[model samples]
Target: MKKIVAFSLLVYCISCSPGPEKNKDKKAERKKEIQRIAVKKDSLQRDTIEFVSYNDDFDYSQLNGKKGKEEISYINDQNNDRSFLRGDLIAIEYKNDSIYIAGDGETPQNAEWIVSAKKIKDGKVSKFRKEYNLPIKYHYSKEGEISSTYLDHLYKLAEYYIANSKKDLIKISLKNKEQLGYSVEKQKKNEKDYYVLGIYVEFEHRVSPFQWLYIDPETDTIYEYDLPNDKLIEFP
Candidate 1:
């Protein structure tokens, strides 16, 4: 009787202990929990801020033709010969005597143009000198009033997309020229009108259509135009 009871107790203990399958399941559950937490954190960060590349081909000369307004020009502190014209859509933030300018991306690091009050009219200077907190978001103008800076951002975005999508193909070098840049046009899709920025790239000395990026003027959301499928797909 003693031997029989001991054997039964040992069987029960062995059955109650967690097996390898249970351990594997527990590990999987823990990994999934960690991934969920990481995704949540990333989503929160994206909601607060977005980054974009600065458009270098923006024409400041367009701003010069505005009637009843003095042309706004800035001297490059590093090189006095290099003059910069402030665009209508460029956002400027002032800190004490220094001014920080946003160049599409999240942080302002490379904008170093100095504009004197004497160079700009008193009223025009005030419009550009508004103090803003860091991590400024670019507010795109209406479809007809799109600024050169915004166009520059769109061009860079298209280039980035092409570089990643066509990794297998030999990379094509693009030159920043007036004829090779983006052009905006209105198109109707899903029974709604959207302003589309058409990206053109110069290859072998010839300008060719590269990609079309559709953007909602009101929301600033971008979509890739699918010509074959006649659809607009949201871009990364």
Candidate 2:
């Protein structure tokens, strides 16, 4: 189940957003150069806190070891200047009875949109599973207002990240009422209660992991040892 945030910290961050950018990689000359993202109004709402079922196999304790905080990095070939040689963990999450795992056949992250799992020959890869892009489960009020919703806390917290996020740097029409984040849709995997977001924000900084991203958990956090494109290992 999801836990509540420590009250004191929440109060502090809520009051003073765009407070500080956590980029150890920047020099004094660029301190005030990065664009600042203002917190949106809807992001500040409060409602009944509902907890998702956390089972033994999917327990938060599974992320307890030193590996939990261990670094994961990836190269941002597009923006080579701000790569993280040893990346930080953007977010770590999981799901169960998920359609990504609903079938049994060869399915990699990109192929997840395939409707049915295909049969594979012996010695061949079977159904593949990966973190679906930012999944959303928004609730609506009878009058069509966004009601108590499962906000993407992970993505929301990214704004408070110490790293320099390009997302903050991007120009959005919030004043024009355009949504800044990715567009969400029903899953193509097995149909489920949630919708996955397709936007991927690329963050660049002088940190060890220069090229960090918000989607694709495989590359979200790059470990000190995990190479780009190598098969990722999940802890039991």
Candidate 3:
């Protein structure tokens, strides 16, 4: 009876003791399960943030030139980083890890600037960079149509204003006045053909008078439109 009882006890101990290989496999399985849970949680968090679409209301032609250069430089200097300007028509979009804001530059190149906001937390931007400078180029489309010449003229006009303006910041736009809209009438100087481009310039101060800019595409020159005289005066 004693022998049989001892044998039964030994068998019980063997059944209870998990082998080393089995224990290692179980630990590995638990580790994988934990990783799976973490991945799922991260995915849920990312899904909670709503995605934004590309906005086309931002016209790059509006930023052609150095109109916003001073403001851009100042912002960068203050923060040691870059950001979009106040008058910039910015379009925003978001991906898994970053938010992107794209706008146009006030340069003759019509350079489009893109800013990426990353490491977001609680709906606030923690980090950002001015990441892209896509220059506008004129090319025939699949339909064999070139971009509007009127638009190109307006871009050059804005570039000229930024180059000459004394104000630290200025905003340019095609004049909203129906009478001052784009015109392709023949303008010739020194026997060279030219087209006229007119735009409205808004100063940062409300007390400043509204200004108009006229550009000569052929000569690449700009002038201030004298409303009363109905003529283009050479711009400084």
Residues 132-232, model 2: lDDT tens digits: 22222222234423223334433332322222222332223222322233433332222322233333333341112222222223233311112365333
- Across 61-122, the per-residue lDDT of candidate 1 in tens digits comes to 11121222433333223222222222222332211122234463322222224232112221
- What do the candidate models score in CA lDDT, each in turn? 0.44, 0.26, 0.37
Score every model by TM-score.
Answer: 0.33, 0.19, 0.24
User: Which of the two, 1 or 2, has more lDDT?
Assistant: 1
Local error of candidate 2 at residue 67 (angstroms): 8.0
What's the candidate order when arranged by decreasing TM-score?
Answer: 1, 3, 2
Residues 34-87, model 3: lDDT tens digits: 555434311211111211112223332111212333222101111222233323
Model 1 clash tally, residue pairs: 0
Instruction: Name the TM-score of candidate 2.
Output: 0.19
- The reply for model 2, stretches above 4 Å from the true place, is 1-149, 152-179, 189-195, 198-236
Model 2 global lDDT (CA atoms, 0 to 1): 0.26
Best by TM-score: 1
Ranking by lDDT: 1, 3, 2
Supply every candidate's count of residue pairs whose N, Cα or C atoms clash at under 3 angstroms: 0, 20, 4
